[model samples]
Target: MSAPDTNTETQHPAHKTPLAGIAIGVGVAVALLIALMVWLAYNGNEPRDASDGAAAVQIETPTGGSLTITGTASD
Candidate 1:
């Protein structure tokens, strides 16, 4: 005659996920980046250099003349 089987040691513990914390961290980082970008965009519209002092030159030969423009360098 066999005795009845009993298992008393099996156990599974509850786990806490770190995904919530990670999600919040990432969200805060994205928000800060967006804020920085917005600030830069808002303040970046001011012209750094003054164009009021720009000058053009003109040259003349015996039969022809030429004009040289100063501030029109194209990349």
Candidate 2:
């Protein structure tokens, strides 16, 4: 018996795993989501022009009467 073969080298498969692809796709998706959130946060906070519509505030008196103060956007 020729000295029992002692080769210990590990051989990797030629085909690549899908994990890398999956990770890349997930990263891109997360990046897009972050960008969208940032865009919404930025755009959502913009000041609105009073000319767009009327603004009203309502207050209730202790006597059960309600008073509404209304003003045009130009105010």
Candidate 3:
């Protein structure tokens, strides 16, 4: 009695893991968050709705002879 030969050229599907997909998703989310923070920080430095102003005041000193002081005693 003769036995039939089995085929040895059949291909099997490659195995895949879920860790790679999860890592890529997390990386994208982190990159977007960092970009948003940088944009907000740059735009937050602009000045708005305010104006600059200044003011001045006058000063004076006494000029009377009776108000003057001397180091010598007066007789």
Over 1-75, each residue of candidate 1 has an lDDT whose tens digit, in order, gives 864754434322212246666888999999999999999998985445547654445666677867565553331
Per-candidate TM equals 0.41, 0.43, 0.40
lDDT of 3 at 47: 40
Tell me the spans in candidate 2 whose CA falls farther than 4 Å from its real position.
1-16, 45-48, 51-75
TM-score of candidate 1 to 2 decimals: 0.41
Clashing pairs in 2: 50-73
Q: Which residues of candidate 3, in runs, are more than 4 Å off? A: 1-16, 45-75
RMSD of 3: 22.1
Off by over 4 Å in 1: 1-17, 48-75
Candidate 1 CA-lDDT value:
0.64
> How many backbone clashes are present in model 3?
0
- TM-score ranking from best candidate downward: 2, 1, 3
Error at 8, model 1, angstroms: 21
lDDT of 3 by residue, 1-75 (tens): 654753434322221345667888999999999999999998895345323322222344465323322231221
TM-score winner between candidates 1 and 3: 1
